[model samples]
Every structure is written in C-alpha cells, then in structure tokens.
Target chain A: MTTAIARTIDAIWKMEAARIIGGLARRVRDVGLAEDLAQDALIAALEQWPAKGIPPNPGAWLAMTARNKAIDRLRRDANLRRKLDELGHELEDSAMPAEIAEGIQDDVLRLIFTACHPLLPHEAQIALTLRIVCGLTTEEIARAQLVPEPTVQQRIVRAKKKLADAGIGFNDIAPEDFDARLGAVLQVIYLIYNEGYSASSGSSYLRLSLCEEALRLARMLVHMAKEEAEIHALLALMELQSSRARARTDATGTPIPLPEQNRNHWDRLQIARGLKSLETSRNLGGPPGVYYLQAAIAACHARAVTPDATDWPQISALYSLLFELTQSPVVRLNHAVAVGMAYGPSSGLQLLAPLQTEAALRDYHPLWAARGELLYRAERHAEARAAFETAAGMTRNAPEKTALLARAAACGQ
Target chain B: MKVIVFVKATADSEAAVPPTAELLTAMGNYNEELVKAGIMLGGEGLKPSSFAKRVHFDGPNRTVIDGPFTETKELVAGFWIWEVRNMEEAVEWVKRCPNPMFTASDIDIRPMYGMEDYKEWDKEGGWLEQEVKLREQIEAKNA
Candidate 1:
C-alpha cells in the first residue's frame, strides 16, 4: 500500500510539476525561485503523502502548497514584500481563482518559450526545457540524453542563473521576436524527437519515451501557436514517422528496412492523424517548410498500399525541394534513394558518387548503405559486397550492423 | 478530444508469455465495443522490451544499451488511442474494459491536445482560418 501511494505521488508529480512551477513563476515573477518552491512542495508531498492518505485533487493540493510556500518566503524578504503586496488577495484565497487556473495553460506556454530563448546556448536551452517544462529530474535528463548527471545538473544551474542575470521573465520576450524564439523552440523539440526516433549511437533504433515526450510537446505547441503552419507540419511528420515503430523491427528485434516492413503492422490511426495535420499545415498557406516537405514525402509512403505502389516521383520531387530548402547532405542522400527508385540504380549511383567525397558524408552510415544498395541493384556484386561491409563496420547499432552484414553476404551468392 | 490509454506491463508480460485464449477473446470483444461506439481510434500490443534497445546521447555522442529493462512498472504492454468528448467520458469508457491481464493491472489515460484548446491564438486572421479549413479538407479526403 505504501509503495502504491508513493508511485501515485510520483506519477502525479510528473503530471503536475510543470503546471505548479508555471503558476508559481507567474506569481513570483522568478522562474528559478518558482522551481525551488515547487520542489519544496513536492518534497512536502513525498514526506507526508505516504503517511497520510493522498489528496482528492493532488494537482490543486500541490498548487496550494506551493502558493503558501511562496507567500511565506515573500513575507520573510523585506525587498520582496512589495512584490508580495502585488500578489494581492489571490495568494490569501483558499481556493484557486478561475482565471489563475485557466491561465495555467498560458503560463506553461510562456515558460516553454522562456526556456528556449535564443539568448541561451542550444544545449543549455534543451536541458532547461527538459528540466522545467518536462518536469524531468536532472538524473532522468542525464540518462535520457546519455550525459553525466552532474553535467546535466550544472547545465540546469547555469541556465537558470543566466536567465536570472539577463532579467528575463515569463512574459519578457517581445512579440516581434516571437517567430525567431518559436523557431528555436521548434528546433529543440525536433532534435529531441529525432534523438528518440533514431539513436545515433545506440543498439536500438527508437526510444519511445523521448519520441512520446517530443510528440506531446509538439502537440502542446500546436495548441498554443495555432497560427504557425510549421508547428502542424512538425507534428504531422512525427506522427507519420512514429506510426512505423512496430514495423521498423522484426519479432527478434532485428532492424527491418522500410521496403521490407510489413504494412499491416503500421499504426493506421497515427497515419490518419499525420495526414490530418499535414492537410491543416497546407491549408494554413505559405510555401512548404522543411518539415512540411518531409511530411509530404512521408505521406507518399503512407498512401502506398504496397512498397511497389509507392509514389517515388513525387517523393523525389519533394526531396529536391527539401534539398533546396536545407542544402543538407543527408537530404541529398535521401534524394538519391528516391531518384534511384524512380529512375534507375545507375542514376542513383551518379548522385551518390559526388557525395562520397563530400566532407559531411565521410562517416555517415546511410551514405554507404545507399551506395551498397545502388551497387547491388546494378549487379556489381564485388563492389556491392565491399560497400555493404564498409557500411556494416561504420554502424554502431547491432541490428543495423546485422542487416548490413547479411546484405554483404547475400552479395557473394 | 483524443486520449491514449496505456496498459502497464507486468512480470508475465515482460516474460513474453502468450495470453490465454479466454483473455484474447475478452479483449477482442471489448475492442469491438469500443470501435462500434467510435471511441477507439486504434490500438496494438507491443513486443517485450527484451527485443528493445536504448540510445543515450551526450552532446553529439551516443551510447546504446540493450533492454530487458528491470522496471516493469515503467514498461508498456499495449496502448489504445481513443477519441472521446472529455476526460470524464474517457474514464467512464475505460471502466468498462475487461481485465487485460491475468493479474491485477493499471491503466493510465492522458488527454491528447486539440485545435479548440488554442482558441486564444485564433485572434490573428491568416493561419487559424487556414488550419480549420485544412482540417476540414483532411476529414473530407479521409471520408
């Protein structure tokens, strides 16, 4: 019973911590102090809840507890006493006011924007957002990102101090800079999703929790920034990609290439959701952004009932547009695959040849993998085998390595 | 609104043992009811985490860890995405579900965000109008 209650409290903390912090930050006008007050309330719950029964509305309980702590701290500080006066009767109120309660959503949104401010280093921004907005412990953030716990702790500390030094408040960011700030926020979320979607160094291809968190954050952004087409596009791209989680691997956990994945295992609902979001993005006007183009490419695959039925020409066209947008070699590599599929293997090989000496493609496994595939398709068995072996050796992921080695072996036959 | 209902993994689920025929039939019948009521949009069981892996990131560095993770409570056995009117309605529907496991189980329900949640952001003309029209187009295309 004690363990169950403890578990419940922990779950509630994860769900409510962000809201509590957001509300307190608005009340105190200090993000750092708000987080500390919220932590104090959480500590209070950990100590009391296991002994006493859980509260009826744990969220409200935490909010009320944190508010009282804020009021107490203010009363003790002479300089902050005037700020306390500004808090008015809302602090003394027994129940949470309707407006303050409704403002919680806006508070959290503002908190996210503040955390992802362009003033902070990109790494610091990501760490701060995960810690504050996601309500993740430093240790959890460390584990998820594969960094040392102490490093994550240091990053969080420095980030908070930097924000305080800059005198940045929850609503301090200007409307004129909203787009630039929103761009940074979207990039951070996208990076988090990509990390979860494909672990660059891990044996597993996907980390569901990270992906889920990113998707959740993206969904939140879409709700908060309904005017942004790119937000919907990013959400659509994630949903469409995530729908393939099941089909991306075999029963034994071996990696399954896209062409070989069983269509029946795909999550149809997610596909539907992705398509809907994409439609919303397109309807919102403006030229296709990188995310929208990628979603369009993913849509091509999702619409195909069979691999052979895939709209390669459309995908190729989208990738070309994407290439023009980002100029990323990775996009070019993908474009090569689409070209190979749409036209012929030789045509794909021609695109891949120029990329071989491109500095960015030096150690990229997919570049080699694509080269191997194009070579194998061209009936150049010896060259294909060499290429697959090189690709296999480059990849750190076990399942991918196994797949590549198997392809290499197949070339010999 | 849409919500995801997660069925937490247990020791038996972690071991990858097959469910009994009775349990399967019970779940099938329940899913049918959900679909018939248009509550369940989609759902599926997941393979055990032993077949899973984790990749940790430190800056640009990534470290991969194989799974058979010790934390069963944190593991998910299956999940369903359902469209419902509100959290209360979702909870009521979840209460009707047959036991998905041989032992005691826990189900966690979380709300999925919708466009209406951002009504505050609709003040600006251009994009919000397009979002609603596009959503309608998607529904029509799917329909």
Candidate 2:
C-alpha cells in the first residue's frame, strides 16, 4: 500500500510538474524559482499524500501547494513583498482562479518558447525542452536520445543558467519575432519526432513516446496558432508519417520496406487525422510550404489502399514542388524514387545519378538504398548488389541494416 | 486526456521472472474492465533492466553502463496508457486494479497534455477548427 501510494504520487508529479512550474513561473516571473517551488510541492505531496490519501484534483492540488509555497517564500523576501501582496489573495483562496486555469496553456507555450530561445545552442534547446516541457527526467531524456545522463543533466543545467544569466524573461518573444520563433519551435519538435520515427543509431526503428510527444506538441501549437498554415502542414506531415508506424517493422522488430509492409496494419485513425490537417492547410489558402508539400506527398501514399494503388505521379509532382521550395538533396533523392515509380527505373536512375556526387548523398544510406532499388529494377543485378551492400554498411540502425543486407542478398539471387 | 499508469518494478520483476498464470489472469481481467470502460488506449509490459543500458555523457565524451544495477525500486515493469476525463477519474480506475506483483506493488498515474488545453490561444478564432475535425475523424475511425 505504501508502494502503491508512492507510485501514484510519482505519476502525478510527472504529469503536473510542468504545468505547476509553468503556472508558478508566470506568477513568480522566475523559471528557476518557479521550478524550486514546484519541487517543494512535489516533496510535500510525497510526504503528505500517502498518509492523507490522494487529493481529488491532483494537478490543482499541486499548483495550489506550489502557489502557497511561493507566497511563503515571497513573504520572507523584502524585495518581493509587493509581489506577494499582489498574489496573496489568490493564493489564500481554496479555489483556483478561472483566469489562472485558462492561462495554463499560455504558460506552457511561453515555457517552451523560452526553452527554445534562439540564443541557446540547438542541443541545449532540445535538452531544456525535454526536461521542462515534456516533464522527462534527466535519465529518461538521456536514454531516449542515447546520450549520457550527466551530459543531459549538464545541458539542462547550463541551459537554465544561460537563460538566467541572459536575463531572458519567459515572455521575451516579441510579436514581430513570433513567426521566426515559431519556426525554431517547429524545427525542434520536428527534430524530436524524426529522431523518434527513425532513431539515428538504435536497434529499434520507432520510439513511440518521443513521436507522441512531438505530435502532442504539434497539436498544441496548431491550437495556439490557428492561422499558421506551416504549423498545420507540419502536424499533417507528422500525422501521416506516424500513421505508418505500426507497419514499419515486422513482428521481430526488423524493418519492413514500404512496398512489402502490410497496409492493413496502417493506423487509419492517424491517417484520417493527417488528411484532415492537410485539408485545413489547403483551406487556409496559401502556396504550400515545404512541410505542406511533403504532407501532400505522404497523403498520396496514405490515400492508396494498396502499394500498387499509390498515386506515384501526384507524389512525384509534390516532390518537385518540395524540391523547388527547399532545394534539399534529400528531397531530390525522394523525388527520384517517386519518379521511378511513376516513370521507369531508367528515369529514376537519371535523377539519382546527379545526387550520387552531390556531396550530401555520398554517405547517406537511403541514397544508396534508393540507387540499389533503381538498379535492381533496371536488371543491373551486380551493381544493385554492390549498392545494397554499401547501403547496408553505412546504416547504424540494426533493423535497417538487416533489411538492407536482405535486399543485397536478393540482388545476388 | 490520456494518462499513463506506470507499474513500478519489484524485486521479482527485477529478477526477470514471468508472472504466475493466476496473476496474469487477474491482470487480464483488470485490463478487460479498463477496455470495457473505454479507458484503455494501450498497455504493455517491459523486459527487465538487465537488457537496458545507460549512457553517461560528459560534454563530448560518452561512456556506457550496463543495467540490472541494484535499483529495483526505481525501475518500471510495465505501463498502461488510458484516456480518462481527469486525474480523478484515472485514480478511481487505478484503485480497482489487482496487485500486479507477487509481493507489494505500486501503480502511478500521470495525465497526458492535450490540444484542447490550448484552445484559448486561438487569437484569430479558427485555430481549433482543424483540430476538432481531426479529433472527430479519429473518433469515427476508431469507432
């Protein structure tokens, strides 16, 4: 029973910690102090809840507890007495104020933007966002990204200290910079999702929690910035890609190539959600951004009930638009694949040939894999076998390596 | 909102032994109740920490440490992600779970943040239209 209660408290803390801290940060105007007060509330819950039974509204309970702690702390500080007087009435009230409750989402959004501040390094932004916004422990963040816990700890600590030293307020993002800041925020979220979707170097192909976290954040962003077509596009792209997660790997966790995957395993709900978001982006009525174009390409595949039914021409067209928008060699490589599907192996090969020496694709595994597939389709078995072997050697993911090696063997046969 | 209920690892779980059939049946029945109530989103058991590894990072340096490192109390054995109205509803469901261990065990519940929480941020006023439509599509697809 003691263990049960302890676990319950632990769980509650993980869920409410961010919100509690975010709320207090708004009230206190100090992230570090807000976090400290929230931690105090957690400790209090740990000490009191097991004996008292869990509170009725655990989140509100924690927030109220933290608010009281903040009030007490402020009362002692001569400099903060005026602030304390301002907050005292609300803190003393048992019921949380409606405005405070309504502002929780804003607080979280502010917290994420602050964590991903442009002044901070990319790694620090990621570490800080995972810790503060996602409520992941240092150890869990380390494990998720395959970094050392202390390294993650250092990044988080340094990030916090940097923000404090820079005198960056939680609401520092100016209105004019909202679009640029939103771009940074979207980039960080997409990076996390991509890492989860295709781990840079891991045995597993998917990390559901990271993907879910990214999706959750994207959903939140869309809600926050309703008219932002790019946000909707990004969300649509993630949803479409994530819909294929269940079919991306075999029963034994080995990756199955897209063509061989059982479409029945595709998450129809996610696909529906993706398509809906895509429609919203279209309805918003602007030229398609990179994400929107990619989402359109993904939609082409998702709309197909079978691999053969896929609209390769539409996908190829979307890729061309994506290439024009981003000028990314990776996009071009993907476009090559679509071209191959729509046109012929030789046409795909012609597109792939330019990218082979494009510097970026030289050591990229997918580039080699695509080349191998195109070559195999052209009946250039020996060259395809060699390309498959090179692709197999370049990849670090275990499942991807296994699939590549299997493809290489098929080429030999 | 969704909540993830974590089942804490016990000494037996740390030892990597499977649960007894009776205990499994009990847990299954509990899961069935959750599903029947339309609360369960997903659930799964985890392998022992023996298969886990921790990477310690020091700036640019990294060192790996093997798991099964004598911290049974801190490890997770399994978890169930449930969609519930609030933390209170989740707690009520958790209170009915059978003991998940041969010995003493504990379950913890944490709520998942949702897009609805930020609905007020729609300054231009149509921000949540897409999200609402998408959610309905998801519900219909699931149904």
Candidate 3:
C-alpha cells in the first residue's frame, strides 16, 4: 500500500511538478530554490501521504506545502526579510486544479526558459528540463540519456548553479528575448529527440522512451505557448518522423532510406497527428520556420501512399524555402535529392556544385553519398563509384560504411 | 515499454448505463492528462460482456461462448495502451486514472512484450526481422 501510494504521488507530481515549481519560483524569485522547496514538499508527501492516504486536492497540498517550506527557508535566512513579507500575504486555499491557477502557464513557461537556458551545457539543459519540467528523477535521467547517475546528478546541480551564478531570474521572458529563448528551449527538446532517434547502441525500449519523452515535452511546450507556430511545427516534425521509426532501419541496423522504407510500417496514428499539428501551424500563420518547412516535407512523405506517389516537386519547393532560411549545407544536400527526384539528376548536380567547396561539407559523408546517388542517376558510373568510395572512407559507422561500399559496387555493375 | 491498462468490469459498468456527467468529465480530464503527458497511445470503453463473445479452442475443437459471462470482475470495461518508460511508470500513470466505473473498480496494467524481451530467443536476429516485417504487413492492410 505504501509503495502504491508513493507511485500515486509520483504520478501526481508528474502532472503538477512544473506548475508547483513555477508558482513557487514566482514567489521566491529563485528557480533553483523553488525546485528545492518543491522537492522538500514532495518528500513530505512521500512520508505522510502513504499513511494519511492521498489528500483530496493533492496538487494543492503540494503547492501549499512547498510554499510553507519556502517561507520557512526565507525566515531562517534573515537576509531575505523583504521577500518573506511578499510571500506572507500569499497564503490561501490551494484546492484548484493547476491549469486554473492564475498565470500558471506563464509561470511554467518562464521556468522552462530558465531551465533550458542557453548558457547551460547541452547535457545540463537536458538534465534540468527532464527533472524540473518532466518531473523525472536523476536516475531516470541517467537511464534515459545512457549516462551514469552521478553524471546526471552533477549536471542538474551544476546547471542550477550556473543559472544562479549568471543571475538568471524567474522573470517572464521579455518580448525581444522570447524568440531566442524559445529557440533554445525547442532546440534542447529536438536535440534530446535526435539523441534518442540516433541511439542504436542502447536498450531499444529506453531509446524509444527518450523519443516519447521528447514528444511529451514538445507537446507541453505547445500547450504553454499556444500561439507559437514553430512549437506546433516542431511537434509535427517529431510526430511525422517518429511514425516511420519502425521501418527506418533494417535488421542489420542499415538505414532503409526514405523511399525504400516500408510505407506500411509508418504509424498512421502519428501521421494523422502530424498532419493535424501541421494544419494548426499553418492556421497560426507565421513565416514558415525550419521546423515548419521540415514538417511540411515529412507530411509530403506521409501523404504518399507509395514512394513513387511522393510529390518531389512540393518537397523540393519546401527544401528550397528551408535552405533559403537556414542556408544549411545539410538542407542543401537534401534539397539536391528532392530536386533530382522532381526535376532530374543534372539539376541536382547543379545545386551540389556550390556545396562541393562548402568548408563545412568537405568532410561531411552525406554530401559525397548524395553526389554518388546523383552521379549514378546521371550515368557517370566511374564518378559515382569514386564518390561512394569517398563516403565509405569517411563514415565511422560500420554498417553505414558497408552500405556505402555496397552502393559503390552497385555503381560498378 | 508499452502497457495495456484494462479497466476491469464492476456491476455498475456491466449494467451498460451511461456514466454520470461528473464521471464523464473526470474521465475526459484524465484522458487529456494522459494525452498531454504523451503516454496515451489509444483506448476505448468496451461494451459490457453481454455483447461480447469468447471463442474457446480445445485440441482444434472450437466453441463460441456467449456473454454475459459469469465472472464479473474478469470482464474488461475499458482499456488504454500507453507508451511508458517502465512498468513502474505505467503503474504510476494508471494510479492517477479516475475510477473507470461506478463503485470500486480496478485498472490492470499489463506490460506488453517488445522485441527486446525476446532477444534471447533471437539467435540470428530472425525474430527481430520477422517482427518488423509483421508490423509492415499489419500496416499494409490498415495504414
């Protein structure tokens, strides 16, 4: 019964942690201290709830308990008397659901911006976001990230310290800073997702869970900022991408590539969700950002009943817009492939010409791979073979190298 | 991992009466929570056992057993398939779910098997390969 109660509290915490911490942070003006207070309240619940049974309004109880702890901490540390008085007047009934709590979403959003602050290391950002936002324990973070527990613990500790030392307050994001801050938040989520998506070495379940966690966080972000097109777009991109995850690779861990992947294995549910989110993004009506463009591209693939049904012209158009916005060599490479499919190999080769000298692409294996594909299509078999050999030499992954070499041999044939 | 959380039937659910508005709202909120947390994959409220049938197979002999079956609690009133981090997480998520039926009820969390669970038997990766192919075929007819 006690274990069961603890798990119940855990589930409630998962539902209410962000709001609780966000509310406390508003009072204490210290995100880290607010979290500490919230955690203390959680500990108190674990000690009491198992015996007392869960309170009728558990989220309220947690918030009230944490607030009292914050007040006590402030009272003990006499230097912060002014803040204590500010908090003193705030005591009241806390039985309401978290969403109905006034300005709670804004508070949570502020907390997210601080937790995913750009100054923190990428791993630290991930740790803090999972802990404070996702309500995950350090052990859970370590497990999901495939790192040692101590490492995750230290990342959380140091990340909070960095926020404190940098004097990052719990203040709402200013209008000017919103875009950059939102970008950081979105990037951290997408990074976590990519980490999960690319991780082929760990327990498959954990890796997939990481992707789900990212999706969860992204969904929360969309809730918090209902007006942001990119947020919905990011969710769409992830949903669309995750839908095909089951068929993206073969038994040997060799990538199936987009066209060759079994369209049937693509998750229709997630595709529907992606398309819905994409529609939402369009309704929000902003200049299509990187995520929006990519999601649009993914949507094209999803709408295709078969590989041949894919509207490469539309995809190439989306990539062109994407390349114009980001000017990323990777996007250019993708655009080349789309152009090749929609137009011809010669058109793709023309787009690749500038990327040939791109300093960033000189060592990039995919550039060579794309070149090899285009050249093979253009009937320059010898050139395609050399390009494939170069790609094969550059790749560090064994399966990828083998695949590239096989392609090279295919060109010879 | 994923789990199928079944809301076991109580006498109240077996009656096939619609839930009270309060219960419906509570469940709606609970479902929204599940979706917001990104754990709810899919779920449905099942019709009572009076409308269900069980096919029993004994040594290639097939028999259809009609409902309503006598085992009241054994029948499922509803179920949810959730993608969760672990059995613990699944249990925790289910713990907060609102009462699925009037009166006392139980929600059983059964962790589904994944490819990794059968890795020991997949000496040559055949199981994993076949699982992917099987998923592909299932989608072929539906997706």
Candidate 4:
C-alpha cells in the first residue's frame, strides 16, 4: 500500500536520518533513544505522509516530530525533573529549517565519534558507523560485509547497549582527547574503505558500494571538519584509489594488476577531485600524515599515463616516508614493493629480506606475493612459483587465491 | 548518480543575446563555485537551433532536418553534467543556480545510465562485455 510514497520516504530517510538522529541525540542525551525516536518519527511519516502528502520540508518535519517524541519520552520516563525542564525550555523553539540549528554539524561529528568510541570492538564500531552515520540499512551492511542480516542487527544492538551501559553521552568528548578521538574516527573510516577495497575476509573480491559509502563518509567529514588536514587527505586517498575501480577488476572480478590495467578506464573526474583535495590538505599542512602520504602515492599513479611513465622513485620515497612515520610492517612491505619498482629487483629483495623473520609479517600472504613478483623479475622462476604457491595457500580470499594460483601457473612458463 | 541539467531555451536565449556583464560575471562565479565544489563534470552552451542538424531514420531511409526548428520551449540552450548523491541533491544544487535567461526559463535534470542499469538484461554478461569493448573502441577512435 502506498508503495510510491513509501519509496520516496525511504529516499528522504537516507538523506535526513543521520541529521535527525544526531540532532535528537544531542537533545535527548542518548544515542540509542535518539535513534529509536528517529525511527518512530519515520514510522509516523510512513503512516501519515501518504494520506497527507509529503511535507514542504521533510527533514524539518522529521526533526520537529522527533523533538516532540523526545520531549514526551523525557517527561513520561525520566526521574530527573530539572534536566527535563532545561531540555524542555531549550527545545521549545519558534521555527526550524531543513538543515537544522547552528553547531548542529557538531552533533553529526559527535554522533560519528560516539559510534566510533574506543570502547567498542572494531567490528562493532564499524557496524554502528555504517548504521548511524552512513544511514545504511542492516541488510545493506550485512550484504556489504558478507555477514547475515541478523548478525549485523545483533552487532548494532549490542554496540548500542554497550555505549549506553558505559554512560557514554552521544555528544560527549573531552576537548583534550579530541585529536586522538578524531584519529580513531578517521582510522575506522579507512578500515571500512580497505575492507571494501580488498575485501579481506569475504568470499567476494570487492564490495564497490562499501568503497562508495566510505567515500561518502569521508566527504561528510571533510565538510564538517573543514580545518582538519587528515580528513581532506583521507578523502583524497579514497577518491584516488576509487578512480581505478572499473579497471582494477576483470569481468569475473579477478583483480588486475596496476601495471596491466587499462588507464583509459580510470575515472578522470575522481582523479581531479582527489588531486584538488590533496592540494587542499597540503595547503593546510602540518607535517604529512599517513593519509596525505598515501594520497600522494596514489596521485603519482594517477598522473602516470603508462606503466613505464610512472614515477616509481617518487612513490618509493613516499612509501619510505610513510614507513618512517608508521614503522608498520605492512608499510615496510609496500615500501619494498615500491623500491623494487624504482630500483632493480635485487634492491627489493634486499629490503624484503628483513621482513622474512619479522614476527608481524610472518605469515602475511602479501609478503610472499611481493617476493614472488620480485623473484620472478630476477629470473628466479622456481623460487617465484614456490612463493606464489605459498601465497596462494595462505590467502583466505577466493579471488586473491585464484590470482595467486594463476601467477604460480604462469611462473612455470 | 550523474545528472545532466538542461537549461531550457527561453525566447531571450533563442535570440542568442549576450547577457549583461553583471549576469555574465555572476554565472562565471557560479560555475567556478561548482568546479570548486567538485560537482561539475563538464558543461557547454548550445548555439540555439541554428548550426544544428538532425538525422531522422525510418526503415532504410534517412531524412536530414535542417536547423531553426520551432517550439523553443522544448529546446535546450545549455547543460551541465553534475555528479550528485540523489535527485534531491541535484534539485538543491539547481535551485542555487542564477536564472540563466533575463526572462523566465526552465531547467531539466536527467540521470545517465551506467553499466549497472543493464545488469538485469545482461544475464550472461555478453552485453556488458561488448559494451565495455565498445566504449574502449570509441575512446580509441576519438583519441
């Protein structure tokens, strides 16, 4: 019944849900309750909008309705009469706009940080962020993460309960802890992006929608936190990497190597945006951060017209800077790959040699994969095949396994 | 989604009249804003119905229709392609546009079809495969 109205409201919900939820969470002082109130407002919309026709300003309507529900709930349930009075007076408004109140963008940021609070498990944090900030449905998150819908729903429910039990206020963050907290939020967004980019744990090779969702989240952050260099840089990195999406996978979804990918298929529009963002980040410069460095590397790749034309030395230098900053074994591995491209294959092998015994990368398939590539270039075919086979065996992802095995088979030639 | 926003032909636009310097400057600023916001992909203005041709094909026969067609209301004087989150976002952006013509005019937004739109009919993916190849070929030819 009223399928068309319901569908329009669904689209409207995606656009307004986060703001309405965030705005209410600030007023009600509880993320979970705020979300429930927002959902109630949505149900009200579904029940009434079809017969009454959609409102002139739907976002404002939703906000006004949610505010009423919030006020009623506080009056009916709360023992803190004084707190309710303050909220009641503060909330009693004359007029509202489609966007919301001033500093409401802070509520959006607060909502993100609340969802990404360090207390929750990383998976749960990610699940909650997808639900609250990205406004994705439980089913969509489930499909994107390749988990069952009920599992995602349970994860979100548990995360909310954890936040509430811990007495975490939806808009509360110590100003002193702001930078570290923002870093966590950025890290969570990056992790979601990487999960989609490589799809490490799933049967599928790529979740393109996840990548897009991450871009949307990053873009939103860039808008809210305009002064933050890392937010812009993170957005830039995602944009540059996403530009290759069409060329990165084949018809069957097997990954195509960067050197082998067709440049013509790259999204020039996204590359331009990425470069512009990188420039913005640079202008707001504080020594280059992880995202800025990575975005620089991606920009190098984006600028290259052909494989031979790629500025591998600059990429190697950027990776070296990144490794110096992060000191992460993964970054070191990437540095080795970039160095191999810039110098001879032997230099790569030399750099990669220490990683062999490094406990952190002991069984990482990418290390072996890098070794396989370098060894193949060194005319060490048998070693290359063995390394490829090792990588093929170690990887859990099906398409990566297929690609590695194909490499191993090719080494025989 | 990518939407092509068509600025409809008003009588003023059909006459190919130049805009006042102030309006021109405002439009220029608007375009610059679009570029800075990273929404505008590309755009151009038409030279009205003049210097235009339409090839009408029926069966094996082809009829070439010359320019200066009637019905200015249906004509598009210009357009800009923008990548936006949804039609609502597109509409919001269009609402911010300066009135293109000195007189009343209209604009239209139409979403472009991407490869995914054909997914249902391309069960075996042959059509997708062929489309990709065709795209590459066209690009190469144009290049």
- Interface alpha-carbon RMSD, every candidate: 18.6, 17.1, 3.5, 4.7
Interface quality of candidate 2 as DockQ: 0.02
Off by over 4 Å in 4: A80-105, A199-206, A396-406, B12-71, B74-105, B132-143
DockQ for the candidate 1 complex? 0.02
What is the C-alpha local distance difference test score of each model? Answer: 0.80, 0.78, 0.84, 0.83
User: Which TM-score value belongs to model 2?
Assistant: 0.69
Better of 1 and 3 by TM-score: 3
Model 4's DockQ score: 0.21
Which one wins on TM-score?
3
Local accuracy of candidate 1 as per-residue lDDT tens digits, A1-413: 87766666765676677788989998887788899999999999999888887776677899999999998998899777665454444345434445433433378788888788788887788888888887778887777777899998898889899987776766555445666777888998988888777752223322445676777778767766677899999989999998887667543445568897768768897899899999999999999998999999999999898999999999999999999999999999999999999999999999889999999888888899899999999999999999999999999978789889999999995
Q: Give the poorly placed runs of model 1, Cα more than 4 Å off.
A: A79-105, A200-207, A396-402, B1-143
Where does model 2 sit among the CAPRI classes?
Answer: incorrect
Candidate 2 residue-wise lDDT, A251-365, digit = tens: 3445667887767768786798799999999999888887889889889989999899999988999899989988999999999999999999999999999898898777899
Query: Model 3 over residues A1-413: C-alpha lDDT tens digits?
Result: 76766677787887789889989988887788899999999999998888788887788999999999988988789766665454444433223344333323477777888888889988999889889987988888888788899999888889988887776667635555668888999999998898788874324546666787888888877876778899999999999999987778787566788889877678898899899999999999969998999999999999999888999999999999999999888998899889999999999999998998999888899999999999999999999999999999999989889999999999975
| TM-score, structure 4 vs. true | 0.82
State TM-scores per candidate: 0.70, 0.69, 0.84, 0.82
Best prediction by lDDT: 3
Query: How far does residue A267 in candidate 1 sit from its true spot (Å)?
Result: 0.9
Q: Score candidate 1 by lDDT.
A: 0.80
Kindly report which residue pairs in candidate 4 clash with one another. none
- Which 10 successive residues of model 1 chain A have the least lDDT summed? A199-208
